[model samples]
Target: MASPIKVCVTGAAGQIGYSLVYMIGSGAVFGADTPVSLHLLDIPPMMPVLNGVCMEIADCALPCVREVVATDDPSVAFKDIDAAFLVGAMPRKEGMERKDLLAANVKIFKVQGQALDQHAKKSVRVLVVGNPANTNALICSQYAPSIPKENFSAMTRLDQNRAQAQIAARLSVPVSDVKNCIIWGNHSGTQFPDVRHATVAGKSVYDAVNDEAWIRGDFITLVQKRGGAVIAARKLSSAMSAAKAACDHMASWWQGTPEGSYVSMGVFSDGSYGTASGVMFSFPVTIKDGKWSIVQGLPIDDFSKGKLEVTGKELCEERDDALAVCSAAQ
Candidate 1:
């Protein structure tokens, strides 16, 4: 057996973390052939809950989990870790402003970024799963100056999965048949769930559906608002699906995406596809050897271009807001 790879999950007591940790422990993220030492972290008040989670993990006796450590200390959770799922963040209250939420999360991620820089492996792969994830990832990368920006990414795979599933259901085809469904820009409502290049069983999605009105109207709107719809139906935010998407993301990042296919990931923008240079933006990406590169040369129609611009603007605004919060604290 390979040496145990150290993995960390923040907010391990939360619903998503509860689902995600079991996946990671069962070798869902890193695979069954490799063993993992799981490090779980949450707030001080959540430690007891975290400990109960650890007990359940031990009771499961997952063969891939060689060890388990539950704690409230970021330093302990992060130390020499190979991968981190940063799922913990301050949830937005009913009356709270967006800027106020950003301010609170910026403080959290900044400290975590510093922890990652000081203690985690140089090659540590960090995925920010918290709300306002793109800007939070940007803040994390900024604070962890010693860690390469490429190592930090926010979860957009959930949005991509939602788009793909919606397309599959509309076409009455298995979800596995949907391919190349692109989720562009922010994970928020401004996100563009583009199927211009998507296909169902090798047929163009446009032709498969043959309804331009639905594709451009209901299809797009539904995918963009799916999270809200989920929350409305369940009276809680998405957890099971979100956990699955997070697993899909890390697994692809670790193992590599299939050839001739791309997935959406919120990575630090290098001005690709006319996006602004320093914000975290989601783009169709292909992975190889644990590295991700933005897919290039997809001709964006005017409509798609406009959608991209709107989401890009929102991300830039968020980046600016997070930076202002940081500056204020200093």
Candidate 2:
């Protein structure tokens, strides 16, 4: 049997954390055969809530969960961790601009990243799930100089999953039938849900539907704005779906994405597709041996290229905005 892995989750008392911890404890993130030691972290004020969460996790009595540690300190939470999920950040409030939101979260990620560098295993994989996640991940990576840049990622699988569901519903097919729904650029309204290379059960989605108008119009907008739509309807941000997407993101990273299949993930851009370096941008990626490589050489039409340009610009601007905050702090 493989040795137990340490998994740390920040914001353990929050909605998404509440939704994700059980799945992680039940071997959803890793595998049923592997044991995990969970480290739950939150702010001091939320310690009581985190303690209750730990109690519930224990009550589940999962065979795969070996130990649970609840703490309010980054040093304790990140100590020798194998996988760390950076899920806690300040949410965007009424009238707050995206730059303002980025400023608010950058400091949090910087501190956490330093803690990870100081305490976590050198091979630790980090996923940033909080809002403005791509930039938050970038900030975290900046602080963790010893950790590989490839080890840090942000959550864009939620957007990809939403895109797949929209396409599946349109074609009256099972969601599992949809493949290669790529989410490009940031995890924001500007994200491009590209279906140019997508397939539905081994057939090209373009030839299956052939509705360029709807694909360019409603399909893209729906995937990009789905988070806002969910908030509007539920009067709360998407907790369950977001948590499930995080699980999917980590699981796919650990267990290889299927052959010839890919998922969109927010990884550091290495000048791929002309995207700027050091920014965490969502691109279609395949995982093998617990590492992700960007899918290369996919055809980009004029429409998709234009959307990529817009989203790429947005991500660069966000990177700059967050970097400015870091500089100001110094």
How well does candidate 2 score on lDDT at residue 45? 97
lDDT of 1 at 139: 97
Candidates in order, TM-scores: namely 0.97, 0.98
RMSD (Å) of each candidate, 1 decimal = 1.2, 1.1
- The local lDDT score (0 to 100) that residue 198 gets in candidate 1 is 91
Candidate 2 local lDDT, residue 51? 90
- Taken over the whole model, the C-alpha lDDT of each candidate is 0.91, 0.91
**Ten consecutive residues with minimal summed lDDT in candidate 2?**
91-100
Report the lDDT tens digits of candidate 2 across residue range 197-224.
9999999998887999999999998998
Q: Which residue pairs in candidate 1 collide?
A: none
Model 1 residue 175 CA deviation in Å: 0.4
- The TM-score obtained by model 1 is 0.97
lDDT of 2 at 170: 93
